[model samples]
Each structure stands twice: as C-alpha cells, then as structure tokens.
Target: MLKINDITNASSAGAFVVKKGFGAILAVTCLLGAACSSQSVEEGGLQPVALKEAATSASTQNVADKPNVLVLMFDDMRFDTFSYRGGPVPTPNIDALAAQSTRFDMAMTTTGLCSPSRAAFFTGRWGHRTGLDDNVALWHSRQTGLKDEEGGIIKRASDAGYYVGYVGKWHLGPNGMAKRGAEFVDTYKKELEEHERQGAPYGRMAQTKRYLAGERDENGEKNQYYLTLKGDYDDTQAAQKVRAGQEMIKSAAKEDRPFFGVISFSQPHPPYRVPEPYASMFPVDEIDEPANYMAKRVNKPLSQEIPWWPWHEVSHMTDNDWRESRAHYYGAIAMLDRAVGEIIQTAKDEGMWDDLHIVFIGDQGSMIGEHGLYDKSAYAYDELMRIPLLVRDPDVEPRVVNRIVSLMDVPVTMAEWMDLKPDGAVDGDSLTPLMLKGDSAITDAEDDALYAYEWYNGAWFGLRAIRTQDYKYVWNPGDERDELYDLKNDPGEIVNQIDNPDYKAKLLSLRKRLELRLVEVEDSSVTRLQRLIELNS
Candidate 1:
C-alpha cells in the first residue's frame, strides 16, 4: 500500500506538495498491479474531433424568435433510472414527455458535482471558468456564487424580451434567482426554513439523527434516511414550487412576450423522503443489487479510499440498508414525476404547449450502490456523469439522439432557439443540428468524445477524464494510479485497465486528448497540476 509520508503547503496558491516518497510508493504499487493484470484491453486511437455545422433552427412555431421555453431541472436523477430507460421505478409523466421530445441518450454534465454543473449549465461555460468548481458548502463559505463570465440563460432570455421565472433549488448561490435575471423567483431555502420553524426540521441528516435516537414518524416506522409526509403532496415544498412555476407560466401567458421559466426540483437528491404511496412504492426485497455492487477497487486508488472517505455515510451500511435507501430514492423520483406532470399540464392548459420548448434534465446523477458507492465522488463513472436529458421542442423532430451532449450545451441551444444574442465565448456546441437532423447531422467523429472533471472533494486531488464511445480514461493527478476502462467489455467500469500493456496506446491517445481539451478550455489547473505530478513522479 502506498503511504503519504508528509503533505506540506507549497505556497499561498493552495497547492500541496506530497513527499517524494509518496510518488515512489505509487510507482512500486503500479508495477505490482501491472504484474497481476492479464486481461487485454482495446487499443483505440483518438481521432480528430469533427464538429457538425449548425443547421437551420427547427422552429415550427410561427414566431420562431419568441417561442415559450420551459426548463425542468432535477437533482441527482440518473438517465438510466427513469422509466423510459427501464429504471427500477416507474416515471410515466417523464416517459410521456420523452415520447414527445428528442431524448439525448448520452447527455453528460461537465462536472458531476451539483453547483459546478449548475454553474456551467447557466453560464454555458466550464465549471473551472466560473470559479465555482466545488459544491455550495465550500464555495459558499468563500462567498462565491455563479460567475457570469458569460450571461446566464435566464438573463439572455429576459434580454430577448421574454418573461423569465426561476423556481425551486438554485444551488449556484444564495439570494433569490433575480441575480440570474428571473422576473419571478422562488427559493427552496425559504420553504425549508419555514418547515424547520414549524417544529419539523426535515432533512436527511436531521431525520437520520432522529432514527438513530429510536424516534419514529407518525406512521410508527423508524425510517433512517427517509420521511413520510402525512398531508397531501401539494402542500409539500417541492409541490408548492411546482405551483409557483405554474403561476409563472400563467403570468407569462398574460404577457405579450414569450415565456422562459425554470422549475428545478430538489427531490430525489437525499433524505429520500416522499409521501405515503411513493414512500412504499418500491419494495425493498424486489430491489436487485447492481451488477457492479461488489466491484473491486484494484488499480483505482480513489475507489479504494471511498470506503473510508470523509463525509460518506455508506461505509457502515449493509446490502439491505442500501436496498432500502435505493427504494426510497426511487420513490422520491416517482413523487417528483407527479409534480412534473402537474407543471407540464399547466403549460398545456395555458395554451403555451405548442410553442413551448420543454427541457427535462437533471443537475447531476447519483451513484445508487454502483461500484459499492453511494452518491457522487471525484470518480468519473457513468452513474455520476450521465444525466436524464429530454428536450421537447415543437419544431424539432421527436427522436432519440445517441450523440454525446453536455449540460453546457443546453443554454446555448436555448439561446439559439429563442434567438437570444450571444453574451461571450461559450464552451459548448449548440444541439440545434442534432435536434433538427438527428444522427445524420454529425458528419464527423470529432465531437464523439466528452470531457468531464472533478477537483473539489479532496484538496488538489483533481480528476480529469476523456470518455469516448468505447472507453474512458481518468487522469488522477495526485493519486497512486490513473484509470482506463474498456466500456465495450466492461460497461459497469468494474475493471481498471490503466496499467495493462494492451491498452498503452489507447491510454496515451486519451491522455493527449484530455491535455488538448484542457488547453482548449484554458484550464490552468491542468498545466499547474500536470507539472506538479510529473515533478513528483
């Protein structure tokens, strides 16, 4: 096992230099791991990314520049977990929306963390560029909010003479959504605070503490991480936000201008709380273990550290506990689907459905016991990277787009569809062509790969990854070993093929691709950390 002899601060830049012994120990471990690996990995070369030209707007609306736009963002919802994707729980409302939309089967967030992904989505810039790469707790402590290097989508739409509104969770920062240029803003923080004031402090931690103290809800059940709402779902904070969004749509309908509203839900994130029927929706016994539930963390030192990692509560959980938690999570999604159905109906009833561009997406996905992990980490697995993205544009052909897309592409796409002016340089491509022409829109394979990163959880333990159709390469700058997964053979990402001689060429190609991508995005961390890692090595 590799050991950290000492970690010392290099300077005021917050960079820490690990003792040379740490890198030496890592080198010895890599050699041992290589000796034990015998499986052959695919040797795929990285080709130049060919981007398709933006096609004409697929606006069937008579007023192309003023079509109503409604964006629904979810928290911690995985693409594969929706009913349309054959997930464990049923999501009829979302499935129906997918049937009428262009579902991007391979949509990913630039960063797997919440605040960073939301920041990128709003600004159409990469997380690092926004300086909000970490979650709210860390960045909020530093008094950082969403950096508008480029204008956010709401501001862009509002500037385009559209009535915009923002409701529910805005994890980007404090204050209401006005900073993002929403005419109407409703925050979940105020609602949560009110619930706490009502002598019911609702949250995963608070409820778990109650459970640990042998406290039970009115239902006489000791729900550890979940709570059962006794009253109607409409009275709940999330459901009330749905109504607030509906009101926004109605108010927009009254205006002569086009409507642009964002209804973001905080459900299905944690605490796993839901109403009665949804709370007991999925039976725990019927919940099957994920195929990679017992996956080993051989060459991946980061995965090995996850079990004992700080702030992770799954270390003491058993299989049954995980299943129960998953069931609760599924139930939460089911409940959220109910609210989704309501908001969609509101838009339709307000006669904005025909001209509305509805976007149903998740901020980031959670790991539901995949690879023996719960919730997200710095790792770049599909569960954490992939999100549920389905866009319903009336003019766009309703079909399944298998091309890789990113959340950063969303606002850019919206801007184009709404005919909003460009604010600044955006780090994403418009998905207008994909929506208008589907797979045939891409004439080249240059945009076939997706670049993702995470650098917040641990100090300077950054991870940058390049994911193609058949493989994933993760560059853990300060870790004992980097990771390469043959996605074709091991879709679960169970085996780490980094040290395998068979994958040497492929690994080198991906490493170069990631380096070039970092340069393209002007990520200074890459240059700084890459130098540090090389010096230590």
Candidate 2:
C-alpha cells in the first residue's frame, strides 16, 4: 500500500501541494474544490459553448416560458435496484413514473460523492470548478456562497421570473449556498439538530435491528432489515422532507406561479431503518447473494484504510446478515417511493398535472455488496457511478433513451425549455431533442461516453474514471495501480485485464481517449501523466 505521508507530501501530483503540511493541503484542496467548481466554457479552451447545439426546445407547454419544474431526487439510489430493472427490490412508484417519462438507461453523476454531485447538479459544472470536490465541509470555506458564482443557476432562474423554492437536503457546502435566490427555503439542517436533540442519528438507525432481523431468519420466522412494531410510517426523514416539499408545491399552486423546486429525499442512503411493514417487505431467505460475491476479488486492488469498506463489513457478516441489511436497504427505498407517490398523486389530483414537469434522479448510488464492497469508495464501478433518470415534460410523449447522459446536462435542458439562456458557458448538452423528438432524435451529445470522479476524499486516494459503451479506464495516480475493465465481457468488472497481453492495444486506445478527455476537461491531476506512462510500460 502507498504510504499516507507519501500521498500528502507529493507536491507534484497535480491537484495538491502540501506546502505547509497536510493541514494546509486539506485547506487548499477544499478551497480549490469550491472555487474551481463552475466554469463558463469547456476546459483547456476559451471558446464559448453554443447553447444552440442542443435540440431546439420545442416546448410542449402552452406557455413555453413558464412551466412547473419539479426535481424529485433520491440519495444513494443506484440504477439496477429499481424493480423495473429486474432487481429484487420492488419500486412501483418509481416504475410508474418511468412509464410516463423518458427513462435514461445510462445517466451518471460527474462526481460520485454527495456534496460535489449536488453542487455540480445545481451549478451545471464540474466539482473542480466549484471547489466543492470533497464531502468534508471543513475543507471548503464558501465565503461568497454558491449563488455568488457567475454561473449560479438559482439566481439565473429567479432572474427569468420563475418562483424558486429549495427544500430537503442541501449539500452545497457549510455556508448553505443552496439557499440562494429561493423565494422560500427549509433546509435539512434543522431536522439534523432536532434528531440530535431527540437522541437519534438522522441518517442511521441502531445496528441492533439488523441483528434482530438476522436472528429471526435463523429461527425460521422469516427475515427483515428490521421490524419495529411501534415505528411510524410518516415519521421517516424522507417522509418529513417530502411533506415540506409538498407544502411548497401547494403554496406554489395557490399563487399560480411557475415554480422551480428540488424535492430531494435522504433515504436508502444509510441507517437501514425502514418504518412499519417496509422493514419486512422483502423476505430474508429469498434474498440471494450477488453473482460476484466471493468471487476472486483478492487480486483486485482494494482500499485498506476506509472503515466502511465492504470487506470490512463482510468479514464479520454471515450470508443472513448480509441479506438482512440488503433487504432493509431496499425497504428504505420502498418507503421513499411511497413518499414520492404521495408527492406525485397530489399534483395529478389538484388538476395541475398538465403544467407540471418532473425530473426524477438520484444524487448517487451505493455498492450494495457488489465486488465485495459494502458502500461507495474510490472505485469506478457502475454500482456507484450509474443513476436512474426520468424526465417527464407535459408537452412530450414517453420514450426510452439509450444514449449516455450526465447530471451536468440537466440544468442546460431546463434552461432551454424555460427559454432562458445564461451568459456563461456550461459543460452539459441539453436533452431537449430527445425529450421532444423521442429516442431516435440525435443531438450533439450522443451515446459517446461520460467522465466520473470519486473524490469523496481529496487527491489522497481520488480516482478519475472514464466510462464508454464497451470499456472503462480508471487512472489512479502515482503508486496506485490503474484498472481497465472490458465491460463487454466482464460487465461486473470482476477481472483486472490491465496486464493481460491480449488487451494491450485496447488499454492503449482507452488511455489515449482518456488523456484527450482529461485535457478537454482540464484535469490537472498527476494521473494525467501517469496514464500515458502506464500505457507505455
């Protein structure tokens, strides 16, 4: 393993320079993370991005300039787990929404961490530009806040004469840049404080439930993530957050305003606490192990330091323990779906469904025991990168898009549909064409590829990965081993084919593509150089 000191001391590693010490490095990393978060043009070039490149926003709304834009977002909900995707967990609410909207099979988060992903989504830029790359808030000092940025979306929307409201979790750094330009705001911080006062960990539940659920399984009493008989269904964090957002929707409707709001749910992320029957929704014995479970992953380079690494948890778990936890994770999602259904049904029943545009997506995804991993890490697997995206415009028909897309593209799409273009450049392409002309209509942003960064930590163990249709290339700087997976043959990414002679040409080609992409995105990391060297070696 690479020494921690070496990681901190390597001044030439591109993204970091210790200068004073690790403390100074952390401070600098956080500063750069928030500062470099938004850019007006493409990286390594000064040419202004043409908003016209997007398919002409042939708005379906009677009033093109004013439509009710609602973003129903979930936390840590991966792509495959949706019941419609053939996963064990059933999500009827999500599937019903997918049926009415254009479902994107390949949508990704630019950075697979909570704060940075949300920052990128709101700002429509990369984490590096926002200086919000790391999840650790202490690393970033958002002195001016996000709305202060020239590329600020909320302010731009507000300027366009739309009523904007922000509800639920806002991870845009400690300064609460998420509050910018909102007509009304109710943040999750107050709930966090309340939970602390009530002696409850807001995001987690006691582990005893998992143990009890497993014991029930062993005793042939069925299985569950937990079965709290007295737990209230409406008392979940998601339930409360959704209620807050519903109130905003009701108020927006009352005022007859074309409102833009983000209804984000903090569920299926952790604490594995499912209220009422959802905890016991999925039976334990029926929960099967992942196909890659116990496979030959010993040869794969794993992060040894993170306490929540899958191996760390798997080391102490039996098959039933794993199943119990897995069942509840899905149960939490099911509960979240109930909250979503309530939010949607309200719009339809109030006779405002015709004016509403709903965008459903997840902030990020978890590993879910894939590759012997329990949660997200520096790995570039699909389990953490891919997220489900559903776009429902009142003017358009339902279709499924096979082309690759990014959360970065969402703001641009929204801007065009609203007939408002900002003065600054954005890194995403609008999906308006796909939405208006169906899945066959092609835009500038095709099914090419997308870039992903797992920098929950700074450059200490950060990894940059490029995902294409057939393969994935992961560049881990310095002494860390680079990984290349042949997605066509090993979709699970179980095999490390980087050193195989048969794939040398493939590795070189992907390295060249990744290098050009990194340049296009202006990735200054030392791994920028290491990829070319490793390819040659």
How many clashes in each candidate? Answer: 2, 17
Q: Model 1 over residues 212-241: C-alpha lDDT tens digits?
A: 555655555434334565544644545655
**Candidate 2 structure quality by residue, lDDT tens digits, 457-518:** 34445566778778888876633577889888988888888788999888877777666666
**Residue pairs in clash, model 1:** 49-446, 50-446
On lDDT, the leading prediction is 1
**Global Cα lDDT for candidate 1:** 0.61
TM-score between candidate 1 and the true structure: 0.80
TM-score top scorer: 1
Q: State each model's CA lDDT, in order.
A: 0.61, 0.56
Show where candidate 1 strays beyond 4 Å. Answer: 1-65, 138-143, 148-150, 189-224, 303-311, 447-451, 528-537
